[model samples]
Target chain A: MTWIMAALLVVVVFAGIGITKWMNSTATENANENWRDIAQAEIANSMVMLEEPDLSEPQADYYEGRIAIAEHRLANDIPSFEYASMQQQVIDTHMMMSLVTLLAVIMAGGIVASEFSQGTIKMLLTRPVKRWKILTSKYITVLLFAVVLTVILLISTALAGLLFFGISDGTLLVWNGSEVSETSFWLEALKLAALKFSSVWMISTFAFMLSTVFRSSSLAIGLSIFLMFTGIQAVFLLQNYEIVKYYLFTHTDLTQFFTGNFMISDITIQMSIVVLAVYFLVFMAISYWTFGRRDITA
Target chain B: MAEQAIVQIKNLSKTIGKKKIIKNLSLDLHKGEITGFLGPNGAGKTTTIRMMVGLMRPTEGEVWIDGQSVQADFEGSIQKVGVIVENPEMYKYMSGYKNLLHFSRMHKGISKERIDEVVKQVGMQNRINEKVASYSLGMRQRLGLAQALLHDPKFLILDEPTNGLDPAGIREFRIYLQKIAKENGVAIFVSSHLLSEIELLCDRIAIIQNGELIDIKNVNDLQKSRYYIQAEPLELAGEVLTGIGFPAVLHDKGYLIDSGAEHIPGAINLLVGAGVRIFAVQPYRETLESQFLEMTGGGEIAQTHTK
Candidate 1:
């Protein structure tokens, strides 16, 4: 059921992004000629202003150079402008994805941990089921919510991008001095979403471990979230920190993977996977041990 | 009838930090009997119950249910044991029936019909559809019991089952517990500080105090040995009875005597001879409260010794 919700949410997000991009593209097309004319008029006015400059020889030279720059900027066609807009949309999509990932982590962090804090975990645990099964069920539920939420954000951003910028099989245009490719843009977006999902899982795992340890949902949630944002920074500040990079929270952000970037020299996808797997197992083991041994007299 | 032991705790000892909660506690809960675990507050009653149900492991003992050790096979032992630890918590958002259904699904081979049967048995048939949040404390307790009984477990362990219950509710709970034990032949091990309820319900009782097993006795046998004798003019009755060679302590308009019916007639004759009216010659059955107090040294030990 959770997986299905995730899939549906992903579809909805993509459709939303597509629709938004489509709408923006249509609006751009409608105002294309007017925008071109406006640019031309502005360039002409700049040329006239340069001719009337109060002449200090260097100032006149600088004014003439500015007019030439304005003319060159205006000579670029509307297509280039539209392409720049598309590039901005991709960046905006990436930002939205990051926001969505954070939201997913928060949601997953609350699911099981909240139950523990509220003392509702007693209800689940006392029911003839093994403690591990209860934890697994909660873990699965959180994963489902995370996947669904991320997919929805991704799809929505994509739909919005498609609606504003017409869908065309062309190379992605990069503005703002950032190197990005269209093929890489969508693929990276998907990978970024996956990374966010993994990061959120890591956060949820931490929350689960804390939930089991403290048996308080709010405490686990608060601590996990605080660590999620600040833990990396704290680890970075530590002088001669050799093993801090291996900390699960340090590798929680999968953006580096999607962006083909590495914060540490030896980090790789396999390494990240191994690190995450270890953290995941350790958290589960601790949770199981604590829960299994707890005296449920309360 | 095959005499089967459903639960057996052997030399169980538990210590949390430096304080020992359960000390060399050994007990046997036989099939088709209601055994009460009696103690004052923090008397290790809850601790012993939790260990039996596999909620907490004993530090130096073994708990076996249906021939399987709880530590060795917790899942197997727990599957056969229905438990309500302290105030049993249920999902407040879910309906009473839904809670039962949720628990029922966890145990393999339990049918929906059995769930409905147990709900009705616990006398919550009409209110089973109501959300648990809306239920009163007593109602929630009934629902908790219903959920515990969903899989028709062979052994039932309830901690403070009558806690927070009114007089009427407590009476109702006792009756239902008796019925369940007798009708289903389910072995019941219930823990509570209320001795009166235990006296009325349990066939046997284990008294614990300060993490020590003070005594375990048949309720009937405990009642038989202890008696309260009533006579007219209770203030002078203690001296009068002592004069008649039957020592009695004046207590609440009566004299508590360790002696039984064999000495009652002789004492009555002697009282009449001394010009004292034998207004009432009543034999008092031992209340569980008195027995518990006697076993635990008048409840002096702290009840918080749960390891």
Candidate 2:
């Protein structure tokens, strides 16, 4: 089962890359001389249109960041740009982290809930070891799986980039208004990888907590994934209410605080971390408490 | 103060929703003995065993193992025990040996040598390396027993431990359980609805019914002494025996008279004196099945222990 998920992820990643490369080839040719330029303008205009109904701070950063990219590409940058460039390739691969998060939810949820579903939890719980240790081992295993997935994602993208555009001595650049920062390509890639994994871990841990409390693996996996993809949007819709900021789902996407703008102005990175920490502890406490008290009659 | 008993269950009760599943039940299990826990279907045997192993919490009261309360100190108490509740469930994706190894990691001082020893003890050595998915139900039961004995726990609780075994396998399991109890001084608590199996296996038997402990007695003392008689003029012989204040029922062969060995000769002499030619008289040993049937008031013997 795990291998199947891995193979599917690999195929999805490379297939997505192939489709994008083909589209770029077709769009870049046989059009007006400034067709690429026109596309950038359209992307910027779409970002501007997303600002209605009080844009989330993270959405604002994302929309405004696209505008920045279009402005820069239209200005003094190089004339020819390819998506296969190392940094762009890395970003494109990392952007598919929702796939990683989905698998992580299954892995984390299956670890404990499978025992219950299959009636094997009696053997697990009756051992001399404490219940907490069992749950902790599964949680750590999920974290390790997250690390493995991140590494696999990075390696696959690097290999793809090397295959498409061999060995380029290009600068890793980030645009912040008039100021631009340059860093080692690998270092920048690692930072982006960490940022992507942060969001994955958040979803995985939520799934792990649900697994502990639930006997049905499908329930845990389904609910966690459902919330992961829609939880932020739900909170965004509710953001008009003052209490929405206190919602854990809103804080679950802590990447907003660091990689972009905070949806709520007062929700700094520190506040987000504290909120996440509280949720983590509460989820863990519920897991241990329920596990200890649960009757394994099944 | 607990009489040297390794397992001391005190007033254990469990209630799920509005139904009181296990009433206040108490039991004592000692080392070097195999006690049969006999009960009909839904008699709370599995529920009691689950609470004993801390797989389920009691609504009230406690189960103590070697002076440690299962409710209060589950690890410390459960460390002294091994259990196979209802059916032994394993990860079918892994080999039997891997399952044992995984369980061994949960305990201290369970070595590869110990694993091999248990594998050999349960006679599963030949197929230990095979994936559990390929195992027959009997083989899985053996693996389950092997894993339970790996820790050398003082008390072993097996709920319907012989679910899938053939008759030969069951007989062998009974012998192994007895050997473990006598040689290793492990107290074995076997809960099964199999009366015949319990008759052959247990030293003492505890009976339960409808969420209550009914009775506990030695296998030897399960039924009172009775005699079977085959005689010419059987009706006359039965009438004479009944007239002499012995209640005699006419059986297929002759008559069934409730009398001890000493009175058998006297009854025979009376029958002969009454012109009844006595042919055969033998002491009838009551099977545990008949006793159980009589006790449960003709209750169903095929009790299913489902968890």
Best by DockQ: 2
Question: Best lDDT goes to which candidate?
Answer: 2
lDDT of 2 by residue, A1-298 (tens): 8788788777776777777666766785543245356547646675665856766555555566555555555564533324556556775555677888988899988888898877889998998888888888888999898888877877777776666555544444555545545556677667767766767887888888788887677888999988887887887788779888677776655556435645565466666677778877888888788887788878
RMSD (CA, Å), candidate 2 to true, equals 5.1
Query: On a 0 to 100 scale, what is the lDDT of residue A109 in model 1?
Result: 54
Question: Which DockQ-derived CAPRI band holds candidate 1?
Answer: acceptable
- TM values, all candidates: 0.74, 0.84
Model 1 TM: 0.74
Docking quality class, candidate 2 = medium
Q: State iRMS for model 1.
A: 2.2
- Computed on C-alphas against the true complex, the DockQ of each candidate is 0.31, 0.65
Tens digits of per-residue lDDT, candidate 1, A1-298, equal 3445455555655565566555655685654455446546645765675576354343344444434444444454322234324433553454455444455555555666566555656566655667777777877866676666765665555555555564533333222222222235566456556665676778777776787677666677688778877876765665247786687755766675434333443456677788889988898888788876677644
**Residue B194 displacement (Å), model 2:** 1.3
